[model samples]
Target chain A: MHIPFDQLKAEFKRVLLKLNFTHERADFCAQIFAENSRDGVYTHGLNRFPAFVQHIKNGLINIDAQPTLINNLGAIEQWDGNLAPGILNASFCMDRAITLAEQNGIGCVAIKNTNHWMHGGTYGWQAADAGFIGICITNSIANMVPWGGSTNALGNNPLIIALPRADGHVVLDMAISQYSKGKVLQYQSFEDELPFVGGYDGDGNLTKDPNAIIESKRLLPIGLWKGSALSMVLDMLVSALSLGKTVKQITDQGNESSASQVFIAIKPFNA
Target chain B: MHIPFDQLKAEFKRVLLKLNFTHERADFCAQIFAENSRDGVYTHGLNRFPAFVQHIKNGLINIDAQPTLINNLGAIEQWDGNLAPGILNASFCMDRAITLAEQNGIGCVAIKNTNHWMHGGTYGWQAADAGFIGICITNSIANMVPWGGSTNALGNNPLIIALPRADGHVVLDMAISQYSKGKVLQYQSFEDELPFVGGYDGDGNLTKDPNAIIESKRLLPIGLWKGSALSMVLDMLVSALSLGKTVKQITDQGNESSASQVFIAIKPFNA
Candidate 1:
């Protein structure tokens, strides 16, 4: 059965309000979730909503918490997310970055202690809609093996870049892995092999068998060593800029929380 | 056959000076070429020196041109490279970015009309040596096929990111292509199949045979569609920022010259 967009959003807002979200916050987040589905990112849209609510129930996300400024260095700023809802914090940070970029030509905001931002493209689109170039990245718990290593030692960090145009904005949102863990599980549920090599098996040989990769927990990074290095560098950049938890630190806690993120906005030449 | 670094640099300087370069310019360019070899990037080092000289001889590169500021907007600046040497222009831009970042915590410099910057890692190392995080990218003539397309439609743009540390810096220099055109040619010459799928053959099937890919001119982008989108976006970014030539325009000229590039530097939290 197909659900109407407004109805989906209204339902989400109702649930969030029941969970103590302010009306404005609830409406904004609900719209984003609805838009994610509208934009065809179902994995991060309705499919992830139940888990998101559970996280709030478990205190992994604090509904009323807001980001607090830590430091400001001209075009660069840092903040503590204070365990706030990732969507709200991400939106606020990008808004701040756009404001700073309006004055400085370019601005960067790094935040620590933020939860998952659901769909990173939301922020990219946010900046693009404001007529600016946007770039954002976030680190997650380790879920992929580094090149030439046997165990999982790297996070499939996601990167987003958006360019504004009169016709249509160009946005790219990608993780460093060839296939995300979710995608692998999806393929495994259907008992289908991946179209390309996705990871290594227990024998340390490359394979396209999703089940083998899942069982081994050895997801392959995109472009082999190149993506591995990129992932590590991105993790370092976010953690260093925010003075927040690293991927290793988050992984060591045995749960994903308090992740670091960076958002940058650049005023276009025409803008 | 072993040559000392100083001797090689001296030889290069002699040749450049004979071609009417100023003493200082000749010395600097010679040192970078020698350093490329010292760093084991033989393709951009001694192996590419003859072509470099030929480009100068052919008037494709100007020995006396320098970058001139076009616009300055606080933390971001745009410059015209005036067809200057890529190494010199890239270094100068990065230096300017570093200075701006020092004053503003983050800075970006974009330039158009630059020539080929051999071994982009040189600039990454330069930034890290000065205790800053550096990120840079340059657009090139179309050399790889975009995902799902049957012809060459994208540049194998290189991206470089560097992070500073107390003991050793981390630097990642990568081209978006799974294997560079030069690497494919090398494998063909060696009569060896690629260790992984490198590109598509004339029949549009993925293959590890370097010869087929070289003949078909269908070098694959890293991570398939992901890198293809990334390469396109990087091109758009550099061109839009500098108001310079796009990959299509550069390829239309049937030669690689007057490329666009961007350099960014950020002050780390500790710094």
Candidate 2:
């Protein structure tokens, strides 16, 4: 139950190698998964490992694919993720953003057709570790209802902001929704109510009942209308900037792949 | 109650000139105030004009002082607001940011010692109107309690994001708090409870009673811990980037006069 970090990472790498992953990619990804768990994000760490493997086996992830430059706009660059592993694509993009920032004081990179980055904060940490202010956002499948709407029309998009500090990096990574579907399902499994109103029920009343919300599939956006509007704008930002699929497009395809994402790095004045 | 836009602007300009504002500055400020009202943001429009005048009269705003460049980091620039009008300073910073973005594909400007820009959305619209993506944030005096803390420690900092669209520009302007103090005061004035939980009562229980929340001074941040963390990081960002006052410092100063703000503009690929 308390495996050592190195052992966990080695196990992940071994499994990836068995699946024909190159030595470098396997080790890099294994370290990320291990770090995610060590960092207490079990949901995206070992717990999600099996799903990730399954997706790869189903050809949803192209292990050998690499992100290719779409266009260069001075300090901003657009990339096509080529359906590659999200971790690698995101990391590569952030590195590019940082390089651009080093040249221009601010850099932005938008990537399209990317897979799910297991932990969005990883890129934020990457930039902060490099002594730059970092911001990133990603759009997902429509999983939330728009404000004043009865049907799902928005993604509970995640946003990340990181500021490097002398003591410790200050990072704020949040999803627009009050709670993720995984969280709701966890509460339901424990037969416990949410501590706060998580979503709307079938009758359209705000509720803490996980089952009701899960059944209705109407997760509440954080701050109600404020979060709804925020989610919509973020979705627009990512998709438009990347010129990629929108939430509706992703949902219509019956999968959550080909997501659009943006990464930005700003050289702090001190830097 | 139904004054024409021109009449309202003229009246504001006349009053501002009486307070010794130059004709150009007075006209610009009055136009912003009138546009806020015309755009249905009464809180920051005519309703706030008298307070703006009072601040000027009290020497809180320096009409003659202009923002001066502190340093230019290529695509990013830092400025000292010289305790000038927030609206003018913010507009000037955004314009500079836009110009930088035009040259480098992205740009950022940070200003310190600025007053409150009446409506934060005004800057967002300014960028969108120029066919660019805009993002801005500003710190305020401490007003909301941090997560897991009973005392006031965080500012209800506002964030604005805007994207240009053919039909209409999509803009999101939101404070970290679920309900702003102004909104709560409005509800209290009408003897009406908030439509949802706005803040904590004196006993530390979430409540919709505006009077109790006001008395307790425990406004709830959006998404509870999430928003609290966001506000803290935003405060850290603006202050760290500008080397200006934090929420604690602003609160200690007994007035929200020398606030720090950041404006960012990104050139869209199509642009």
Residues B34-58 of candidate 1 have per-residue lDDT tens digits of 9998888877899889989999998
Candidate 2: list runs displaced more than 4 Å. Answer: A188-192, A201-205, A209-215
Alpha carbon deviation, residue B175, candidate 2 (Å): 1.1
- Evaluate all candidate structures by whole-model CA lDDT and list the values in order: 0.92, 0.91
Chain B TM-score by candidate, in order shown: 0.96, 0.97
TM-score of every model versus the real structure: 0.97, 0.97
Query: What local lDDT score does residue A268 receive in model 2, on the 0 to 100 scale?
Result: 90
DockQ of 2: 0.77
Of candidate 1 chain A, the 10-residue stretch with the lowest lDDT total is: A180-189
DockQ of each: 0.81, 0.77
CAPRI level of candidate 2: medium
Q: Supply the TM-score for candidate 2.
A: 0.97
